[model samples]
Target: MATNLLKLNNIKTELMVVASPSQSKEVGDVLLNVDGCTIRPSQEVRNLGVILDCNLSLQAHISSTTKSAFFHLTNICRLRPSLSDPVAETLIHAFITSHLDYCNGVLYGLPNKALDRLQRVQNSATRILTNTKRWQHITPTLKHLHWLPVKSRITYKILLLTYKSLHTLAPQYLSDLIQQHSQPRSLRSSDKNQLVTPRSRLRTFGDRAFCVAAPTLWNSLPLHIRQAPTLETQAQMEHDPPGSLTLQLQGMRLSTSNKSVEGYTYNSFTLQLEGLNVSQESTYPVFLFILFSYLFIIVANLGLAVLVFVDKSLHQPMYLLFCNLSANDILGNSIMLPRLLIDMLRLPSERLISYYECVVQAFTSHMFGTTSHTVLMIMAFDRYVAICNPLRYAVIMTNRMLITLTVSAWGVPLVLVGILLGLTIRLNRCRTLMKSPYCDNAALFNLSCESVFINNIYGLTFTVVLFTASIGSMVLTYTKITVVCLTSKNKSLNSKALKTCSTHLVVYLIMLFSGMAIITLHRFPQYSDSRKLASVLYHIIPSSLNPIIYGLQSKEIQNFLSKLFKSNKVLASK
Candidate 1:
């Protein structure tokens, strides 16, 4: 009987072997594969509802022969065919996990409220599982088990056994804490007020639960399970704490390592968890640049507006075009820059934007952008109209015409790309971890769970059309100016015309090409960094540079700015 008992229960091993009658004639079966745990074929593993056919008394844990264990080792083996064997790893997972729950009363090596919650939940679950008839098909008959809690003595002993299991699982933490428990250092008198914990809305459990359980659970917990009292004297008030119980169970130890973005592999008494591997891609600076740069242009344009209004001499077609171009650039940045910053700021690289946001950006960015683009085209046309036909320019490009034109620009984008925002394509489910600070269109598209075939297609089409139109109009407009200058009879007018057209061409190329190039690079995975850098140049940096470039290059604008600053400084000093 002693030999039989020893063979029947090897508590030290992580693998729990149970026996039952085999469903088929096969004597030996492949129970599990540890890696990639997948079950064996249904009929093959079940062998027709039987498990332990050999009938070894120790192997009774697997056998459904006696109405006890229905989910035997055999069924598990078939269910989880793994490199590590489904039968073994699952049993291991459950055993350690369940035991940890019971012992969590340990916090910082002391039995505390956290551990108490675990114990309470465990006891309640065990009570429900034990008392209900539904679980009986699994456990041995309640009366026949030697360790079954019987008298008060048996109950107390079982309680000790549970404490021992907890200590082994979470050795680093305390079962509960005292003032000197975790904080080994001493506190000064002035720091007393700082020592008190805050009363917060976030904590789930009441303070009393932890406060009460702290001291009680810690001292009573046993270090080892083998020393736990048997069913006979378990009820007796032992009074003394059990610190050194023998550990007979052999299994992988646990860890509380708080590393992020990594997985774990376990070994005996030691666990190895891989650390996070960061990606090489970087693009956040570009978004930031876009945001700040456009803001500066807005400020500079407003300043220029104040200067123009204050000085009647400065109010002319050229200055008006300058104001319009600044506005276009400001509006252009507004389309995509702010939201890109917001997305980067709010979530990690992995979290995808809502379908609507992606569509909205794709569409409205185009809207504000198309408006800006058309406005840019108008700016070029205005310059042409002014230099070529200065006398008729006022009548031709009146304020009303400009207003109607700006409205047209806004409306065209609203109508065409409007559908992009309302629709959501369930593309690839993005990893919640954000790669960049913002949720740019490309980032969201990448994170999608479904196919982005349409998004990409429409995106490409819009890019080519809008980009080509804006650049084409600006280039063609400037080319006409160059031709007019070469052929014209007046040297003074031609010189001014050449200078103005050339300046606009420089600004136009910088604005259009840089932004378009960055956006295009997003399609290629390998060039993401380069794309981000380009976006920075397009978004914030260019906006900042725009005012400076025009202010420095144009003699009329520089003289105007110098007088305006002198006026401001004089006003401030007064």
Candidate 2:
């Protein structure tokens, strides 16, 4: 070995051997002779800043780290009085904490007593930086500074390497050690990004092997986090400091708890939205078109609604319901479009919304949809009373009755959707990416890592009840109107009733078919492209068409619009 080293221009003095724990006792008294060079068996070897003992206990490494850390901490404490807080923190981190974290992955699975020595070093460094008294607790200070405990720091290092290995960003040796768990047949967890944990015979030694320990920790993370597309995204999902990853090991639950091992709190989550799959060239054109559609929806719906509010002669039951429908159109599109427009200008990766904003958007969306259907149902009833019981219509649909119905139309949806969003807020969300153009109840609740069975049941039940009540009431009222029309002897009454009901019926059918198409397209992934288009259209089309249908088809509204326009022309001429 010496002669070979000489041939390669390397010195033989660099060669050292620390025997395995099993052979340590026998080799402790023995010396090695290779190619006329005499070498002694070392009890501990220092390589690349880590001290590895014959038994591989890592005690020497930990002791060296803590000693060096305390040495730096002592020096920093002496100058801490002169240094500002930020400068002091920088010095401490540079001198003390960095030493503790150097190559700390090899210290995983050590006994608590062994790890606590290094923990004290960190705790002291934190205290000196913050000028915190020794009698005070340290956990809060560590959390405030976003520092992980020594044990968690060790786990973080290992898991980070594991993540890199799985993503092919680590060394080939590490990538080779990681094996993805696979099955011959599909299972419930088939889509979960799980790794195969190799079997280990000994708890102390075998369990610490990279192949065993890496998979064991990797599989414990939530499925959504494990499946994050990028390392930055995974770090964001964990809600740790910029470079650290939080885990639910040793009583921690992804920073959800305030106990030990819990390093940070999640103040808010940023969600990623998947908008239309437009090419770079088409993005601006698509955005402009969507902007035009949204502006039109606002102007048309609000214009019609304002016209109804201003014109006292058009204050009858059917026109009042038309006004309600117009308001709903403006609201529904507003809930979806403004944020969507802003997101469209951003890159796909930059399309982000806060957790609270998402919940509000979702709640308003449900309210807008449900209230629109309710108003349509109410319109059918209004037509039924007008055509079938014209004499009693004035008496039945009084001012008080109109107020009550309008209030119910808006208030009931608010309460129901409030309850739905309340359920969603209580869930602990593990995923931050939403595969939708905008926030909705379905998309928001699906981000939670836990089972949303209850949310699904309640949402489905609310939808079913709302649809049943709206559709049933409309069908029964229209059926009665049909029977009355066919049997009535008055041609004038028949013609007026058909004209009035046609506009409402057309608007209702458009909304119903568009909604149904969106729901149907979601069930088939093959129709994802179509689903995105349909979802966008579902919000904008009904809103845009309702005002046009009412303005053109309803004689009363048309006459009112004509008079308003003529008066405007007369004033302009004057």
Candidate 3:
């Protein structure tokens, strides 16, 4: 073979010492220098790590005549450990090649920084697993188990290694140095132009005329030249913020969005855009109090249901409605809290609900809500007649009439809610934006771009009529019951009536005034958050307090629960 020689600046070397024995003498000179780097040998892989076997030893030769470098690798993994000399030599060659373009990359870190990590990972026949927390469903990844079922451990190690390598390498590159790597890295248009412009490639190194005798890189990149202030500042201004990723076209970005941002910034007009910035990591403290309210209601209601169902002696008409209300309280929460739990797990962007789904959800929620209100009214009337007009109570509220009123109580809300659902759907929901976690009628109407005159009118009219009719019935029934009780000749009936009606009166008024205030606020365009929160007190506080009210009012319910708990304790002791 023909012979040739190269000279590299500062570090002279005869690479023929590392060449193959059979190879003819040849030399290709080149300089290889880095502006910045933090390269090192990777950590030792634990357990039975990679076992590589090979016949050929790694041999690198610089061809001066043809201007190329050749590497013959043999058992190279065992010798060099990481990124074998052959690979490093090839990388050096590519870094030096002038007829290359790497113009679509945007990075700011050192080259070959990740190459130092390859050997730390080793191939093993057996796999590994990890452990995690109580709340976590899948096992966690904090510590690895040395052995695992191959099928269960389906993640591929090689792909993981490559990704980690990229991560380690990416940060060291700036947007300008467009060096063509062994496997191509993308460069931006500016970087591509910079690469094509050969004069920008090198700066003086070591204050000497450079010479190299290897086919690999021989670049003279000075420390200050690596970060030219004028060039870097311009790069920062163009790409760092208000500049387009690609070349700016006549002074505009690519999309139709009025959002002008190269990065996430700006606080101006933000509350109008996002409404709230809730962190996923934090739980609202108010919800914990709400949880307590739910827990108390559940424990109380379950106790009451058990008493009515198991203790046959306690099963009567008045007690039956109490049980029904308790059960309804349970059902109401079943519909609400799970939704909040799910919403907590997701990011805000994923919390978006389709318009149709929102309308249906709100419809169902209010249907149950209004049913609870109407049920309280019926309970009021039942206690009213029983206490004041005891002799005529059975005849007046016959089973047929009770059934009819109950049916109407359930039916009216269902029908009104259906109408609300149909009316809300008439508006095109393409532009709809929900302001609350779950849908609310007021929020829906507010989101409509089209005139919401009919929607608001119907909602206001229905809310008024329903609240007045229910509240009026309670007032008239209780007042009549009161007059009758005070004037009754029977001393026993008067005393019983006063005690019974007093509790019902307080509970009814608590529910009524709160419900009316809530409906009243909806008529206003905006209400304070505390005012809105006041309505939840009507629903949540009453449901929680009902058991306490009834258990205190009725001696029978208290005794039943006390006896049942004692029996369970006896059974447990045995």
Candidate 4:
């Protein structure tokens, strides 16, 4: 049947039998005949670059790995004299370390004698990279290089795979093998993010299966690590702390200390901002310009919001969305500019921010930015309804609908940003220096030492979703509005619709272009200064200009301001 299935699938098969040492005697000389081909069982077979023996002891695999690693190490050593340090390190990692780490997860629960063989290969590579002599100890050197010993590396691999499986990021086969611990009732351990460790009947072979071993190691991790929202955060929380290497080398079981894991906790961070990079003579003038710009952004956005709230005529749906946009602008700039202004007055070295403050700044800034985009999208929809369905505009865009849209615009971004910040704030940072003048999600993310694949995925997903939804909605609405304006016979209505939309279109275009420039420039290291300037402008320019643009374009606001000024003049004359 197996041969028939393989034939049906067009697969050519070579089969082998792997038995434990005790069963090998009973299963001696097993042979089979299929399709006129005689196949005899072998003592050892190479599968997927790993040598599997009949006893399943893995000794053959270790010997093969060490032999291959030493071969490359010897060649690297021969060329080491002429190679630079960085090049030599890269070569060692590419050749020796990769071989050692590849598929090391399967090496879990291996005897010390077997693991030591792989460890020796790692020691040799590190020694060769650092030019350390045979007489010297390799422990400190390995610690300095931040290399985890073979056993610990195996554990890390297993735990990482387990995390991926739990998060649905792994293959379905792997995911099916693992399950999260659950109970019918609330318990103290319910929230611990524990995995269900499957029972294995055999201690030697069955226990080493991924299903059994993965959960065993995963459940042993710190609670904080297991609860981490992303892989990078988990890695940072589980990173090797001081003395972990020594424990591994001493043949002791690896255990993480809560204190050591949290030892790198920072109360504050110093920002290394690259402002306009002006000379000392130009610093104050530039500072003054930025200061006044901030002042204008605050006053203009707040005043516009206040005017919309106080005036009954401007309480329409479009104006209400505009007011929300204004509030978001004020919020976005206020999160960044006040600190920026303060930092300008202080010495560069004195520019410090508490950890929580930085997190809050990043959270609020991104939240408000997202809110701005959503508000603009809502505004576009508002204009669409008012222009295309003028007779039913009041019915469709009622006060209840407007309030709901407004609340969602703010609430949805808050939830998204909150999740983002929750993940980001828990990351263990390896560095505190930020090159830009402000705290942002990208800057905060770059400070972590671990791989941020999950964070990047989530952040990119959020950005794509926001951009797609907002841009798609605006495009669809505006297209309908354009069609209405062009096809309509009433010239007066067309002009009014066009005038109202022109202001929003201008604002949206400015925001879209500035945001795109910042996002694009961030990918190139050479344009770092330009990127920083663009980031600063992304916050301030829209806020500072939105009020001026709306005031000049909207007749309702213009007439309201004119009336107030004329009334003040009449009161003064009386």
Candidate 5:
């Protein structure tokens, strides 16, 4: 091994002991040899052109790197009079910017004086590019060049690394630095699955560590920006020409000549909610009718949820699942109706929403709706067991079983919708106007200027997984239940089985076909009043019908509500 090491090319070795303040005077050098080469001892060593000192202040490294970068930049500056803008930028990026960005995250949490040296190198480069005086402010120059400040560049580097580590197929060592924060309560749904940074005690270690700087920078970004899948797109989303992120960071917008930023368009994103086909004269009556209907849906679902919550006798797994369905109904309607109402009653100009906001609304609406489908499938499975496997039903539907099924019903849909939303945000939405009244994945995806094969393929994948897994499960479960009922010796048992399963089938058909119809319309678009009407019905029918389906079909709920209402009436008369 020693003879083999001697044959290696361009390799040099050094030793530097990192001793604490108390051991500063006690340590002595020890000699070592590798391939008959004596190890040289020094206070600092340069690896990958970054300096590391024994004290670990990082000050010496910063000073050395800045000096070297500035020396190259000054030589490039001498040719600036002869070079064009693009050529000059290429030279600066190759020589100067590359050095500053390399291992910048290591300098994180260092004192301001250490950063000042690097900042001075950057400022000099900007001055050479713009031919501006040294005394002039550097903010505008940085913005024009689309360069983040030295501190911001460090943060950007760390955050980009963290994003890749968490979302992409990263190596195990880098991936282990951050963990998803799993808390019972989150500030917002968007914040629920944030990556947590581990704490450290050493100031330099903590400051430059990936864990400390990454989470702070990641959390500081808006949810939409953080949701961006790539560092390139994240930077693109953050760079709005008129009021950019850099301006927001400074707390004041800088005044500069109106120059266009390369590779960015100043166009604003706007989406209009689709309106009802009714004429202006009849719009008010339709609006009023829709308003009353929305209120009734909310009141019915809320009342059912409360009944399930308060009535101890009705606290069975089936009723608890009904409560879950009703809650989802309320959520789905809440996402769609308020915006629909606002668009119907207001002028056309008032109906516009930004691209990111549209993505969020579309994501949430689908999440709740998909969750409802999953819960319905679970209910079907529940009844199938009660009828087909009567003896083991108790064991199969235990409290632990019920909790696991319920959590999966909600959890699976949330993750699926989040994946779809993340992919949708990456698309460049060039078209501002949408014909649909409400935003959805299909509608917004169609508005993108680029080819949408990935989006199309994923949409089909979602539909297949949802229908084949969920609906197929329901069909198989019900078919088995039918076979068992016909084979049963007891006629009364068969009658009881039919009654229980029929209600669930009816509810399932209503939700399944409504969802299928919406997807059909979304896939094949034609300008018709029916498209808008279908969207309205898709949002309305499931929510409004949930209470009626469960309440009328449920004998126990009817008995409890009848006695409770009568008792309330008697008290009111007094």
Candidate 6:
């Protein structure tokens, strides 16, 4: 009788049971006519919702589960036209992926062909969501959705399970399975904190077993990633380190070999030129416009720089700062505008640029742009000394001090952008269509396949600190100058002070507003069309207008130009 029996194990839960044809004997015959128990040979048996088969490979269960999932997915796809993306994603997850994920820990060391079968299901699922054609690229789509690949996902789950086991006591069996190594090594991190996976002789069982697979996955994790507070955080930890963007090409196991461009093997990254949106009809006009603007930027900024350098009488803290601004304008424009003009005129088929070149352009643009911020802060400090304490101005901002400030103006931006570029060059850029006239750092960053949180954090920190210091110093200096002007009894002195400060104020305002507009547009993708326009204006307009604004308004520049033009007229008459 089955009533008082020990371990009556073979139970059936579904119809259409499968067994070997040679062993299709009746239950009563096999049981030797046991009194109270009977078996249903036609019914299927399940353990933990996973059907067990005569073969121990788990092949039949995986096959049946996959088929059931696809059958349900095919029905769901028919409702695609009426389904929103979120709803469709929900349905796919509920019906298809849930089946794939269920008891997937048992699939740790499955054959490649078996894993490939499941991978095809995931690829199809992603394709369905994006409505991508069969032949179109899928890697970028997966990256955009932040979905880890099949192999990585398996590793992620295993490592996450290990993390939980280490941190929590609820899973006593899992915790006991992991044994920390007792022996220590000489290496820095080899303090015996690592879990030792017990080796097994049976390869099939060993590879699929939890003890072996879990420690292998756990040991691969960096200490920081392994120390994650929760399973969700552990799941979110990236497969590679912060500056490991380029390394992920090989690390991801997505491809066997890297693609070659111009005889050099590089991670494929194409930068799109977004700001050159002018039509064929308007090409020459735009070309001429940019050409003339560059010419004026060059002539104006260089002319001011030359004037400040050549004229001994005009050499002072103020004009030296102005010279630095002119020089920075030259540097910033030279980096971006030439490439932009070339790109704008290039044939549509020949528009592709080297990935390294794009990175260089982004670095230089940010370097000079940020240096301009630093120089302006120095200029503000100079103004504060001149206006607030004219008697001590020379002593406080001596020649040596000005030299140090100039060096800092150039040096500080280099350091900040060096860190940024160092991080940037390591990223795996998947998309190449640059969305601006030139390779903007922001657009370049957006194209990366790996986690750019470190890049983003550093950028945010630099911007906040630079802008805060620049704006705060300018406001404080201007406030003090205004108070001094109000308290002064001499109308002539106040008038002169206002005139001296007005040109600098006008230049600062123009640069400040243009910079703010460009940053705002950059931060918001919804302003895409406007961002392109703003980028062009930010790069060209400011460089073009800075010299014009200073040349037209500054008495020193105006006087120098007048004298030079008179000398030219005298020479022409001769």
Residue 525 deviation, candidate 4, in Å? 0.6
In model 1, which range of ten residues has the least summed lDDT? 260-269
Order of all candidates by TM-score, from best down to worst? 2, 6, 4, 5, 3, 1
For candidate 3, write residues 27-85 as lDDT tens digits.
22323333332222211211122211111121111111112211212222233346544
Q: Provide TM-scores for the models.
A: 0.45, 0.57, 0.49, 0.56, 0.54, 0.57
Q: Is candidate 3 or candidate 6 better by TM-score?
A: 6
Give a tens-digit lDDT track for model 5, residues 416-488. 9988877777776534556677788877776555578998899789979898987798879988988898778
Tens digit of lDDT per residue, candidate 2, span 1-574? Answer: 5545653323434434544566666655766565656666566778899998766788989888888887888898899899999999889878887888888888887886577667667777887888864324466676678787887788878888999998899999999998998889999878898999889977777788889999998898877778889999887766655433445543256541233422111122767788777788988998998899999999988888888879888877888877888888787888889888898788877888878888888887888888988888778878888999999999999989888889888988988999999998887754556788888888887776457999999988998899889888888988998999999899999999888888888998898888889889988989887888888888888888988888898777888878889999999999
Q: Once all C-alphas are superposed, what RMSD does model 1 give against the true structure?
A: 22.3
Error of 1 at 536 (Å): 2.6
Off by over 4 Å in 3: 1-284, 520-528, 535-538, 566-574
**C-alpha positional error of residue 402 in candidate 2 after TM-score superposition, expressed in Å:** 0.6
Cα lDDT of candidate 5 equals: 0.75
- TM-score-better candidate, 5 vs 6: 6
Alpha-carbon RMSD, each predicted model: 22.3, 19.2, 22.8, 21.6, 21.2, 21.1
Show model 6 residue runs off by greater than 4 Å.
1-266, 269-275
Model 5 vs. true fold: TM: 0.54
Task: Provide the lowest-lDDT 10-residue window in model 6.
Answer: 256-265
Of 1 and 3, which scores higher on TM-score? 3
Could you tell me which residue pairs clash in candidate 2?
none
Residue 380's lDDT within candidate 3 is: 80
lDDT agreement with native, every candidate? 0.46, 0.79, 0.47, 0.79, 0.75, 0.71
Off by over 4 Å in 2: 1-268, 568-574
Total backbone collisions, model 1: 82
User: Model 1 TM-score?
Assistant: 0.45
Q: For model 3, where is the 10-residue window of minimal lDDT? A: 119-128
Q: Which tens-of-lDDT digit does each residue in 400-424 have in candidate 1?
A: 8777766666666676555443333
